[model samples]
Target: MSGVAKVVAFMQRSWWRAALVFAVLAVAFVVFGRYAVPPSTALTSGALALELVGTRSGAVAVLRAFEQQHSVHAAWVSITWDFAFIASYVAVLVLALRYFARPGEPDLIDRTAAKSAVLAGAADCLENLGMLAMLAASPQQPPDWLGFAAFATTVASLVKWVLAAFAAGHALWLAWRKLAQR
Candidate 1:
């Protein structure tokens, strides 16, 4: 088998491991997310500022205000925490689609959906990088690459959510079918 095929086989066999990782990281994301920013501020900016800020100054101002309330260190740590969360989230969702679907030979659609989970995870990682870069630079006078980072972060965040929603819907459908069989 090719390297990619081998990796897929491994993933197919490792659903429980992925679930364990997801459980651990989910806890971290929830805890650090709470300490990183206020719940009200989250409504406005969110973890990676899912809402469009439209301008570099606006983005910087928001980050600065966030840092003032919660130290920049917490914000940085939260961004790092997101990395772990994204990886585990993708793995568990994709593994579920792979192994928990109707018991039969896998089809092209199943494979594609699993791959999309990885793609979504990649997009999320890019989103995290852009957010971290912006947060790191926000303390400066003008903030380096503020426009590009913020724009990329927003776009990636949107892409990640769309793919995530698809995975979630697919998982639910599989779950319903499984339950109906019982």
Candidate 2:
């Protein structure tokens, strides 16, 4: 078998390991996300707000809010941690899909769903990069690129969410079908 096929086979057999890593990453993500919340903002609200900020003005507003609450550093910390979370989630989702795939030739839907998970992770990474760029810029004297960054970030975030939801939903459907057959 090709190296890629071999790796996929290995991952299909190691879904539990990916799941355990995902659980750890999820808890860490939550803890860091909580820390990212500004005093004036609701719990984990800042993170979501940052992700959805589609304009330079919106990005500045969110950044200023975090600055006022002295949580800008915390926000950065949380976003950095999110990189690891993205990897864990993508791995677990892909592995789960592979594990549940039917025997013999791979189903096109299963392959597409697995690819979606990877794409979602890539989009998430882009979103995080854009956010990081915005965070590094001063709210009062924001860079000329801030607007483009904000727009791109929002786009990436939306794509990430949509693809992830599709992948997760497909995985659940596959699981249900498999269980029903038993």
Candidate 3:
């Protein structure tokens, strides 16, 4: 079979595995957030981080605060865990799109949804890298590269969400039409 066909077959057969993996990763994220990062911080959105830090000095201050909270190790661990989360999230989301289109070939809505899910995961990985860079340099002023990282993170994040929204809307519309045709 073609690679695409193989992937579709795998997704069709193993969506539940993806779901289980996603659930474990989700729980890990929540636990890590509670102990190390705030839920808002976990998102790793550059705009949101800048809003929290306010300025270079603010970044130092916040890092100090995080240190004082004795959550630094947990925070670092969470950063590493993010990779697993990203993989699992993408798998689950993409598999869900495939599952939704099962018993037939995927139409445009399913194809779009799968593509959007993959894009969102890629964007999220970029955002996580940006956050890790900042976190690694915490308690010190961020480098000039932070600006670029932040810009990339913000733009990618926006694109990811918008595409996901379009996918969701399409899914809903498609579902409605299917029901109406019955």
Number of the top lDDT candidate: 2
Q: Global CA lDDT of candidate 1, please?
A: 0.67
> What are the TM-scores, per candidate, against the unseen true structure?
0.73, 0.82, 0.62
Scored by TM-score, the top model is 2
* Residue 145, model 1, lDDT: 76
Which digits, one per residue and each the tens of the lDDT, describe model 3 over residues 1-182?
76445555654566585466447657765654454334544334322553234345555555566666665555566666766666665655564455455367787767878788778778767766665665677465567765565566566657767776765565555546655765
lDDT of each: 0.67, 0.80, 0.59
| Candidates sorted on lDDT, descending | 2, 1, 3
| lDDT-better candidate, 1 vs 3 | 1
1-182 per-residue lDDT for model 2 (tens digits): 86445655655566675466457657765664454443445216777888899999999998888888787777788788778778767866776676667877768999999999999999999999998898898999989999999999999999999999999999888878877998
In the predicted model 2, the residue pairs found to clash are none
CA deviation > 4 Å runs, candidate 2: 1-43
lDDT of 1 by residue, 1-182 (tens): 75434444664576675566457657765665554444455434545453355358767776777667764555566667767777667756765675556566667767667777888989988987777777677455855578777787788888888888888678778768866887
